[model samples]
Target: MGVEITTHVLDSPRHRTSYLSAGPPDGPLMFFVHGFPGLGAMWRPQLDHFAERGWHCVAPDMRGYGGSSVPTGAAAYAVAEVVDDMVELHDALGGRAAVWVGHDWGSEVVWSMAVRHAERCRAVVSLTVPYIPGGLTLEHLTPLVDRSLYPVEVFPLGQWEYMQLAIDEPELVAEEFAADLEATFAVVFRGGDPMTLGTPSFTSIVRAQGGWFGPSRRAPKMDRDETVLSEELLDTLVRAYGKTGFLGPHRWYANAGEELRAGRPGPGDSRVRPPVLFVHASWDPACETVTSRLAEPMREACDDLTEVVIDAGHWVALEKPGDVNAGIADWLGKTLRTGPHPM
Candidate 1:
């Protein structure tokens, strides 16, 4: 048979991270980090592909997700704490300087990992979100918002108005999402719509409408977008969210101020010397990098960076797995000189 995915739990001194692994134990390590409202299982496609190609691939459910430990307070979810978790997990898994890959909030963690613990990372890859040396928060993000799509007069927060909702009313956002988990997942997990190009993303109006689902204050019922969320994955997500609730995930935003302050640039912050790959989701308007200045900081900071544009939305990996895998495989081939297997 082929490589089989296996679940493994690693307990760090501070927290516990549950992860899925494939490939031989001694193979070159590759850590795949997931984002908000997502579990390690979200990287199933990547894990399978990389494992078959002779890489030891591991994807972890970050703190407050899946089988991972859920800390008591929002402050516990700060970037520093999250980075510590990744570092500790890396150590527990043989302490090799491994390739780090992330998407969305996971990308935020990879950016930090490359900075705070560069010794542990061989190379870094991010999808959807790019690195900001000063930190990826409202302070740095707000100035970069595409003002044309969101006129400062009417949309002060731009597409990130919902982020303010997370900051100002974390509990409310969590409660609303937890109130109707299935509907919430269905609404949140859809594939990108090409028709949304050039138009304001749905996120731009979160503040004006009072919440993700407007006055309803809950996620509206939606069919699972098969293009992005398959039934198996949907079932997996529903079960994961059911146990952990939205509190842990939403807390990620609640700790933004503290995280950003800690992440402010210092002496060597401007340089990320490792070969880097940034995959731009062309249809992800809210995290829109294709037409916005949001990616400029990442471009300026890195010495060797390659960019690819995928014709999918925010959930590019799930929406177009083949394209993503091809991009990554190509990158791995050109960037590193290692053989497929450890032998």
Candidate 2:
């Protein structure tokens, strides 16, 4: 909060972007993009840290989450379109190929940028979610499931069942989360446990259980996980989801299978040519990467790659900000020092 971060807006015929700006305007540019159920403010800790290090930081509320434009349909939240939004935001921020850092679904967008617009990137850093080569659709992910834990007979899609729920019953999923944003955040943002790495994730049973809260179709009442969420962030999330509802966030995953089949993101578009840093959230069962095949595509495709494992949950950035920051900072420092630069 000491870094004097300011909010700004950009409006165009197609969309609107509301972003938080910190550090000197002319300093080395870096962008932090948030994913589903997140706002620009989710990156406040990151923005402040990097800004203090003399890096101009910008974190934008991607398409459906905060002050940004909330388009009505799922197609509007596609990777190509979302990348276009970032392209515009990047251009607006002086057209510098920045060091782009992202999390969750944001990583998908960042990877797409590396594929489609490599020239606009100085480097790419992704936390929790790894680069999925083509895209993060179930098609690519289903094959990568740890079959020993998620057998084909029962857990067809493994930990991604909740995504299937979102894709199948989008409105209901949204309404359930929107019904009690506080409780929703409380359950969703809990810290990860390394003990449960081999165990099945709760997300695997969402469809069979008849939604996130089982038959109740609402989030169960629980105290917020202070280890993963601060009161300010919880309140900000409640307020934001209260205004926008969860539909827009869910929409981001809608039609994902079809989109991949149509080659909008091109499953074959796998090679990544930027200095990449992937943070493995060892305790995060859902986005499990350390022991799973999920990260193989990224490793094979990215010629310049660095990997670090953090013992935190899917909310790795919030659960262990120091580790996440240090990982990225180390990667950046190494990248800059070994100059073939223009990542």
Candidate 3:
């Protein structure tokens, strides 16, 4: 069934946000943040599920993507700025802190909020992306690199080559990518096989092969594989991203400087001492479990943290909505002392 959806645009540095809300009144607020190449609508499944449970579900089209303002400069898309926008959004909704949940880059922003603005977040759920402390940067993560998949010689820049492509020519990259949003979405969201970790690094293949879809730059047919993302859903994403282009979302990578990338504890670091939950995507390529090490630091930073592993791609909410909803409901019941509402 379709969920009640309400969305607004909040002006940030480069772009505005299409913030969508769902659920019943006086219910616990659950804030959602979408990842790269995704808009707030990505959480439709979760919104539908949670709203039935009488919870206020919110998903924002973070900084540069969707209906939000698309600022020209990369500096505007920093994690800090994104976090601040969320904080303001939460305040505007009500004074109370909501159950914060983020996916992909949005997950990174949620991590920042949990660390820097604990008071604003009652609980935290991060999908795909894990919390890396201030010290861990792309450089630091290089050592943990599975050399088998990504040979240092060829993929020296690691997964960063994609970022380079986006940063070097935002408009061209967007235009080139805009030609076939469906193909791009399909190719981009396709999760990597875990077994391949021991073989050639997929990141390397994409880089060495000159882009993800090979030299052609054309995305393949939209095949419903393990992702479970429906054609209607895929079309929604295509339309939203196709209109805005990826420049704003791509700029998020460039905006995250050493300070945000490092993830150093700022003034509000200790504030996220509440019950937190992290849903790790077993097959997420970007924040690959077998490749990227996120579990360790998350445990260290969050005094009360719950971790769940879902056999899905980076789009965990859509891929495993039942599991995701169950996890959230279970945590809310135990911690927030609430029960799921009937649809």
Which candidate ranks first by lDDT, i.e. highest? Answer: 1
Q: Candidate 3: lDDT of 87?
A: 73
lDDT comparing candidate 1 with the true structure = 0.86
Tens digits of per-residue lDDT for model 2 on 1-343? 3699999998989999999999988888899988877888988778878898888899999988788899997788777778889999999889977889999888888888888788888899998888777568887899999999999899999999998899899898988888778889998889988789799999999999888897787888898889899999999899888888888889888744333345454656557888899999899889889888999888888979889999999888898998888778877887866433211
- Candidate 1, residues 1-343: lDDT per residue as tens digits? 5469999998856888899999888888999999988999999888888888878899999998999999888789987788889888888889988999999899989887887677787789999999887776788789998888889998898988888888888777888888888888889988888899888888888878887887788888888898988888888988888888888888888665344464454636547878899999999978999989999999998888999999999999999999998998888788877644321
lDDT comparing candidate 2 with the true structure: 0.85
Alpha-carbon runs more than 4 Å astray in model 2: 257-269, 338-343
Report lDDT (CA) for all predictions. Answer: 0.86, 0.85, 0.70
Residue-level error in angstroms, candidate 2, position 109: 0.4
Ranking by lDDT: 1, 2, 3
In the range 1-343, model 3's lDDT, one tens digit per residue, is: 5776887665544334568888875777888888878888888888988887778888888777777777777787777777767877777778577788888787778877777777777778877676766523555455656555566787776655565556565665566567788777776666436664344435545545656566666666776554656787788888787677877777776655334445556534534586887887777665666345545666666788777888876677877788988987887677765443332
TM-score: model 2 vs. ground truth: 0.95
Candidate 1 clash pair list:
none
What shift in Å separates residue 154 of candidate 3 from its native position after superposition? 3.6
